[model samples]
Target: MLESWRWYGPYDNIALSEVRHTGASGIVTALHEVPYGDVWTRDAIADRRQEIERAGLKWVMVESLPIHERIKRDDGDLSQLFANYRQSMANLAEQGVNAICYNFMPLLDWTRTDLTAPTRYGGTCLRFEATRMAAFEIHMLEREEAAEDYPADVLEGAKAWFEASGEEERNTLLASIMSGLPGAFDRYDIAGLRKALALYDGIGREQLRVHYKRFLEEVVPAAEDLGVRLCVHPDDPPRDILGLPRIVSNADDIAWIMGAVDSRANGLTLCSGSLGANPANDVPAIARQFGDRIHFAHLRNVAKDADGSFEEAEHLDGDTDMVDLVRALLEEEARRKQEGRADSNIVFRPDHGHEMLMDAERQNPPGYPLIGRMKGLAELRGVIRALA
Candidate 1:
């Protein structure tokens, strides 16, 4: 597992110098300034790669080259959108970026109702409070047929939570919920969001899954030819949010996806925090089963609650068995080495860190506080060293 940090391009307050001091030698980044449905031109890709090289960090993976809403909905001049996608991959390949990490979750990328929940550790951490989320769906956003998804008790809890929350708290919650993950979908306004939702009104979970397969069918062959591995990231929180479908949730979904494309280039990003949000998902088992096709990894853990809510825990503190997971990767890496695969680079980053210490004052992105991620990288580094 190559130790890496996710950088949100040049504008991020966390500089490359800061990243270097944190003991990470690789970077997981993207052309974030580039808009969706456009090509990341060859010159632009080369410039970014050169910038990373100058910082003494290898550009290991692209966090994403975002798939546009039009592509997801199978609409809006897809021929041109797909052509741009192919051209982007070609650009990345030329720049030596082999693994591209992306997701197919419709509309929002990940949702969490609370930005700063009191952790048992006496510091603030990111959380997914169910009640606050319902307040948005049932009373605020008010999507059609939203109530059918929750139980009676859950609905009541949401009401109570909404009634108790102040305007500031509610605003904080909404901001946190809509803050898209790095390189994932953008936040949507009520009208803009509704328009995006309308495109998928008749499309069920199965149809969305098929649409994703079609995307890979069109995209992966080019990826294979260019030696670029297209790594589909799992749905964050691993469930449906805001009446939208999450296709890459569990092992079966991933298996179905791989079966759909049946190509080495179409692979999984293997995010522990995302999959661990669902207690039913056995992360270690999935690692073993699909280890061969796992081109990228986002290693972090989550503490899941019984009512289908969760919070970001320390890298090793969550429900996922870090020991078992790391060991499995070690075994897989050894096998790949024995098989003589040239590009055996498994780009792993410490996903979703706690906001703590000096980072308390810094405007670090949610779940990406510097100190917490530094600690996580050190812990993961130790594990990798011991395995080696």
Candidate 2:
């Protein structure tokens, strides 16, 4: 596996010079400035590549070229959107960046009810409390039949939380879930949320799967033609939170996705933190099973609670056996080498580190604190070096 770091473009607090100090040769990033549905011009991609190269880092993977919501929902008549997306892929591959990491998650991207959950070490880690999230969905967002989505204990817990929360707290919860974390994607207020959710009103899991497969059928061919690997990231938390459909969550989902398009270009990101949030997902086993198709990896762990709560754990400390997972990925790389495959080394980043030490004062995006991720990268590096 090749070590990499995710750098939010020019305005990111951790500069390219600092990324070098993290001991990662590869940088995973995207042109976040380019608005939704807009083409990432070849010139823009080149300029970004030049910047990373100038700092002695290679832009290994486009962390995402975000899919438009209109494209995801398939409101019919998507010729232009598909054309633009294909153009973006062509532009990226032409710029010598072939690996693209993206997700088909609707509405929100990795929702968390609490941004600053306290850790035992006096640092903060990202967390999702089931009851608090339920409260937001039931009492705050007020989605019709949202209460039916939760069990009796969760609904009762949500009631208690909702009644006790002040207006400010309620508003914070709304922003965290709806805003798509500011730098990630578009922001949605209550009206915007309702409008977006309404788009998927009649679309359940099956219909959503239809739209997803349709998307792959169109885009995967373009990706293959462009010599680009499009890796679909697993659904964060591996479940539907806001009543949206889930297509890529478990091993079965991965098998279906791989078979859907059935091309080497159609790959998986293999985000451990996201997939490991669900207890049933055996992280190491999945890595071994789908080893060849995994083009990218997000290596982080989480401590799970019985009530669907998950707190970000240190790189090797969570429920998933980080060592065994790394071993599996290494074994795949070794196999690829023996087979003389071109994509032998998978690109991986230390994902979603806790806000530790001076990170509290740094105020980088939640789960993206420099010191925390530096620590995570170092720990993961130690694992790789020892195993390899």
- Best candidate according to lDDT: 2
TM-score of each: 0.96, 0.97
Report lDDT per candidate: 0.85, 0.89
Q: For residues 1-388, what per-residue lDDT tens digits would candidate 2 score against the true structure?
A: 8999999886578889988989899999999888877898999999999999999999999988888888778887998888899999999999899999999888677888888888898888888889998998888788878887778998899999999989999888887675454245567777778877888888888888888898899899999888899999999878887889888899999999999989989999989999999999999999999998999999999999988889899999999999999999999999999999999998999998989778888667778999999999999999999998
RMSD values, in order shown = 1.6, 1.2
Residue range with the least summed lDDT across 10 consecutive positions in model 2: 176-185
Q: List the residue pairs that clash in candidate 1.
A: none
Looking at model 2, the pairs that clash are: none
Error in Å for residue 11 of model 1? 2.9
* Residue-by-residue lDDT tens digits, candidate 1, 16-69: 988999888999989988888899998999998898899999999998888988
